[model samples]
Target: MDTTQLKHLLGEMTRAEKIGQMVQLAGEFYKEEDSENTGPMHEMNMTPKKMTVSGSVLGISGAETLINIQKEHLAKSRLGIPLLFMADVVHGYRTIFPVPLAMASTWQPELVEESANVSATEAAVSGLHVTFAPMVDLVRDARWGRVMESTGEDPYLNQLYARAFVRGYQGQDLKNDPFSVAACVKHFAGYGAPVAGREYNTVELSERTLKEMYLPAYQAGISEGSKLVMTAFNSLEGVPATANKPLMRETLRKELGFEGVLISDWASVGELIPHGIAKDLKQAGELAIQAGVDIEMMTGGYLNYLNELIDEGKVSEELLNEAVWRILTLKNELGLFENPYRGANSELENNLVFSKEHREKARIVAEESIVLLKNEKQVLPLTHHQKVALIVPEDQSKDVLGPWSWKGEPSESVSVYEGLLNHISKEAIVVKTIDHSKNDRPKDWLDDVSTADVIVAALGESSYMSGEGASRSNIKLPAEQIQVIKELRTLNKPIVLILFNGRPLDLTDVVQDVDSILEAWFPGTEAGTAIGNILYGTKNPSGKLTMSFPRAVGQVPLYYNQDNTGRPLTAYNQEDKYLSRYLDVDNRPLFPFGYGLSYTQFSYSPMKVTLSKSEREQTDKIIVETTITNSGKVTGSEVVQLYIRDKVGQVVRPIKELKRFKKILLEPGEVATILFELNQQDLEYVHQDLSVSVESGEFDLMIGSNSEEVETTTVYLELKKNE
Candidate 1:
């Protein structure tokens, strides 16, 4: 269908039908014979008439279910416009891959894209038209449960992953591609940085901070062709993001060049009433439509009062037509008019749901995502000959499929015990599975631990402990698991801690108890096998931390790129009591961002920077290079990270910012020279008055494996006058 046909279809739609096209309801609304007074429908004041004509449905999949729903919706429609089916196909569909946080740890956007492609393929076959994924929210707080959904804290990394996900989900063409589904980049404006790390909490960020730190991720995704944008639940600068005109209209539409549909998260449009901005649902609907929210998700505000607002002169008919036009345009792009059931195929779904090939890809990604956090005395790479003592909780089936793996099966997942069984003979290994649900500790396993050479303890938060609606004020290991570690610590054998979590944990208490620690943030369905391979050295651990692990919960929002305070804590001022130093704890994080250890070691030589032209020209390029050598005895990959700090700026600058990085594989004792090019414009930041410009000053360039541990060198950057 072309523009003329789409416009004709819209012209034929009634006022109610046009408003219905801007509403997306749950699948339950379409299932019941009379859904008007059922459950939350009556509470939201949704009538049965609106339910029959809703433009989109969410949270229902499977080819048969969606085919039936779409057929029913089209049958009821006067214009025969098919309803869109969308879901939160975040990480994976059936063959669950590692969570997005773990995927980001791999430092490989291509692999991340592959995982998204597999997810889109699986969901598309299940009859989903759009996926609200590649969240792209820059998060610094581990306590924010949705951190699992985001890539990491860095804007550059998040921007790269955002683009990769968009490419994978949308592919070359959404209409022509059978495997691809339209991507919806979500939580439009700063939903990740909720105050107190609580879900749906208020976000108070300046326009400058929002542009500099958060908006780039969403900008990158939209620029890469994401079809839709979801409004956040939080309020930005005292204005609800669902109805913030400056952000949704000016920044997103005019400045960022996003011509796609804008939808609300859950019932955010209706939430404006409770947010104190609107007095009633009628005003809320008007504000949302006027503010440029194209769709109201899971809310009846648009259906109930949007047309009324248009008649009362609160909203323009042009605005309503524009919103409906975007929706109709998307429907045309999805080829819904030609074939409503685009990718629905039962046979294809059965064959591709959890194919062996997809599982292999998940295993490969999980292997790269498992970060080795600590390996004191080189206790890892446990030989098969050594008798193993595995102490894990009994209810470990769901641990593999962490939160947001809504379609993942716990029974189909391999447990750590099941994976380790293949490597060690049954009689050679002693397994002590304690039922954590009960209060009792298994003292009977002490004898097995006394005889074993090494103890591999699998412990961390449960699947529900760290994803949407699961924020934790105390982001520490569960007390029961910590007690288990303490009991194992009484013995002389070295303990290998394999963590299965969704967010960065406070590991200060147990860091010393375990000899080796692997930060495996929910390695999806093949979690057990991936851990087994990395433990036995079949696959090397190369993943780095995307978010900083705080020493304590007090440092909840900690990151390496923190602002330099007036009273900075330094080596020379260690004894200065008035300085910005903690009285009880060190200011450093337990594990800094980009910090991870490999089975093999790589060392970086002093970095050298060369200027291309006069420094004043912001477009001039500067080349930075360093020699990296694999010093360890095994072949491995290293993520050589480059960071820069503005020595002086108009506004206070961060200690350092991650400019660029390279993931290189090297043979034992082999050396390679790595080069990174930086443009003078890259060093610019948002000034106090909101202008962005690079100041002529000295800058420090650093290169290292991680953020905290790096070798620094000085370089002078000049800003030339206009040509």
Candidate 2:
């Protein structure tokens, strides 16, 4: 329904009905722990479970329990205001696909989208209505534990992902789609740039970076018909996002024109007191309500004191109703109110949820997303005939998936040992040396590696290690993991480190200690076979680094595109006293943006630029053409990156900005012509006055595999510099 319909429907509602729309209760009463986990969770505190509430934030359970929990909600609440059920379906809910960072490394938008669809399918079958996913925060700092949740540091890439994940979750229509669910674009704004990449740390961003580099993905989600927009935990520019009218009303709703319901991050409303923004709980509720937040999650301030705030006139009834109207509209759009039992399809659950077809797609998505981080000497693609020693953590059989796989079964999962056994014969010797604990040490495996043809060291954080509040102060392999790898390397046996993680870690030593590294971010149920295929040389590894592998933790927000300072040190050739340079290390990042390796080598031909005003049909149009060839022995895929720079702009444009990129798969000795259309839009940059414009003088365009390696040409646009 439109706003008018929502408003009319809201006008007829009683105070309780209106309040119900704004309240989001925790999901504990109906979710049984089943003697599996014994934790102090509020969900387990409820005596007789209430079926219907504002929403259900499932407190960790599997498919059956999640569905039963929702069924109770629909069967109980007054007006049957069909409660919305939401879970952190970050990468994949049950099938446990790769974490966002690892998935981003793949650089395949379609595959990313497909993975989200699979996640939505799994959650929907379990009666979940929404997923707080596709954490589109632009992160430059790897130290931030939440990097696992984001797409990467670049805004443009996140924007592409924002639309892709939304399409994957909820397609053209949502009311009748079984695989679709409303994708709640999260952390609203500036949550990724936390100080020192610490959890819930304050962010201080310049206006230009926020708009150009951070906000595009959020806006993209809004345009893609996102039904809900979640507020972030951190404050933006001095205002807590839960109560910041400028961010919630003026910017998000007014300027960007998003009409969806505004939901707060967990406990962010009452959190205003800690941020020093609100005097008390009542004030927190009043400010957030007036600022246009429709649904409050966890913070009891709203459910308890909002009526008093309304009576005091601190929050207008109109403002409250507006929020209620938006919330109700979303519920209706979700088809919850029309048919309260809309999602409780027991028949569908019997057919779907981990079905063979769904599992097959999970395998494909998992396989493609496993990025080969390093494969020096072309040592990978191990033979089945060789004697193999698979030395992994004891949890390897269980945590083939890193995180968010409560509904996923490891029995259904293909482990490295099982996969190898399925593919190889008795002639091949496969040894397994697994000791789950890091403290006990795997010293016995050191001798095992020397006798083996190759060593596969599979290690990483147990899925629960680095997500949400799971941010770490130190981003490195566990001590025991480091020790095991160090010992294995002494054997001079080929070592492959299979990394299972939710985010990027400081793996500099691992990069050097092993022959190759495969980043299989919680590779779901099909991890075993997918990984086996890569090791046995069936699937060529095409994944690249989405976030950089920093040389050290001190290099927290390092990236390729940086600005030139007043006294920028000239490379290693120039001597400097105290310049904008690191005394201990080079200012350049360990790996530049768009850096990826392939099994086969690819060569970029010299670039050609045509500058006839008539040929381009516009004086500002600059077209660049380049040829790329697979110069090595095997088939592989490469991302052709295009960057542009204005020789002189009103403001200091980035040294170079990513303008375009294309993922092309090539067979051995294949050559293809790649053309990038250069328009004035491609040349746009944030100016001194805070507007995007194309400054005309000399614009240099370069095409290459990564940022540093470039083949270039120029087309000077001698037009009026945009104001």
Candidate 3:
């Protein structure tokens, strides 16, 4: 339909119908059978009329189900607008890949884009028009369970990944594409930095800090043409994000230039009541609509109270019309009127869902996503000839897919045990399950543990222990698993700890005993194949940690980039009592960001910076070049990272921040020169007064294998006036 037809449909819509168009209901409400009213719908006392003409449905998929619902919906409406189907296709749909955290470890935005393309292809065929995904929230506190969904801690990296996701999901042309689903960049404006890392807690940050650190990734998604933005569940400063007009309307729509639909998170509009901002549901509707939320997800705030509020002259119909117009335009853009089925085909779904080709891509992603954390005395890449004793956690098989599996089945996932079996001879492997519930050690288990040439202790938190609503106060391995590790230590055998988890864990206690550690964060469907390949040296582990792993829970918000303190901890002042150093432990993460070990070693030459002129101008660019050699005997890949520090600024600046990085693969004795270019524009930051500008100053540049270890150099940047 054209703009004229969309306006005509809007003119014909009654207040009730218009409100329905702005409200999104759950899939259960539209089900043909199953009269069981679950928590959300029953509590809202949603009317039947609202259910029939609802604008969209959430958490529903499949061509048959969506087609039946759309048919029923269109038949009941005077002016038919087919129901929009959406689901939380966060990672992948049916063919699950590694979680977003693992994908970030690959440091390959194109690979992530390919994964998203496969995800979009699978999801679009299954009848989903939108995916509430590519969560670009920059995370520092791993205690937040949703860290698995985010790219990582750094803004630049998150920005890159967010763009890749948008490109992958929406493709080049959203209107003409059937394989691409509209990407919804979500948790807008600081949902990641909850107080004490609690879920749905208050996010308190200065406006400058918010703009400088947290808001870039969301803006990047918008720059890449994301079709929608989802409001975060947390309250920004004092205002709940859903009802914060300043943020949702002024900063996002005007300042950032986002001209798209703004949707509330699940029941977030109603949640404003408990947030103490709204007195009742009516007030919630008034605030949300006024704040520029075009769609309400799984809530009756719009359907129940929007029309009444408008009738009372408390809310304007013009505001309601604007929302309805955006919704109608989206449907029209999706070509729903032209084809109600929208590109959903059962035959395509059957062929593409979890196909061999997609699984192979998943295997490649999984292999690159696994991080080799520690390999003491070169104990990793175990030969197949070694008799291996594998001790896996009780929930190992069940939790392979991690959280947000949605349509993915655990039965389809390959566990560590299965992967080992596939790699090594069955006779050479002795498997023992360590029941996390019990402390008993059977004689057979102890006998196998002592006799085997090597022990592979596969342990981690269960999938349920992380993700949404699964925050933990103590981010450590389970006590039972640690106890089993202690028992394994007695045998004096090489213990390789393969950790399967979502968030970064406090590994200070366990790392000392384990000879080698591979952090395979829920390698999805091809988990076994990827882990097996990495184990037998068929694949070298090239993954790096996106988030810093803390040595203790006391360092809850630890990260590599931090502001310099007045009393800094220097080598000369190491014995100074007043220095900003922890007495019990050093102020360093257990594993720094971008820290990962490889089977082979790599060496870097001194970095050189070449400026276009001796004195730089604003337009002048500087080229930073470094040579990396595979100094070890084997071929391997290394993630070369570039970090920068501003010596003096208008305000305090971080000691170091990741600016650019490159992943290079080198054969033995082969050298390659990597280059990164930067200008004055790249060094700009938001000042305390909300002005964005770059200061002329001296800066420190460092190129490193990881955040903590680097070769340092100094450079100066000066901006000259345009002639």
- Runs of candidate 3 with Cα error greater than 4 angstroms are 35-40, 614-619, 721-723
Clashing pairs in 2: 28-43, 51-72, 51-73, 52-73, 402-463, 402-522, 414-528
Any idea how many clashes model 1 has?
A: 5
The ten-residue window of minimal lDDT in model 3 covers: 613-622
TM-score of each: 0.97, 0.92, 0.98
What is candidate 3's lDDT per residue for 68-141, written digit by digit as tens?
Answer: 77888888887887888889888889989999999999999999999999999999989999999889998999
**How high is the CA lDDT of each candidate model?**
0.89, 0.75, 0.88
Which pairs clash inside model 1?
615-718, 616-718, 616-719, 616-720, 617-720
Give the true-structure RMSD of model 2.
3.5
Q: Rank the candidates by lDDT, best first.
A: 1, 3, 2
**lDDT tens string, model 2, 1-723?**
555866666777666567656867556534464321433223322223322335445444344565565566656655455667777787776566766777787788888898888888777766778888778898888777788778887777888888989998886678777567889888888999898878898889898878777888999888888888899999878898899888888889987789998999888998999899889888888888878889878766666677787888777788877887777777778776565444556566767766778777777777667777678877788876678777777766657765555466667677777767766763465556556443664456456457778888778777667766777767788877887788778888898888888766778767788988887877777788888888887888777666766777777777767777777777663577778877887666656667766677899889888654644344656667888899999888888988887878777767777778888989999999988776777677676577877755787788998887787676678554555
Superposition error at 555 for model 3 (Å): 1.0
Error at 385, model 2, angstroms? 2.1
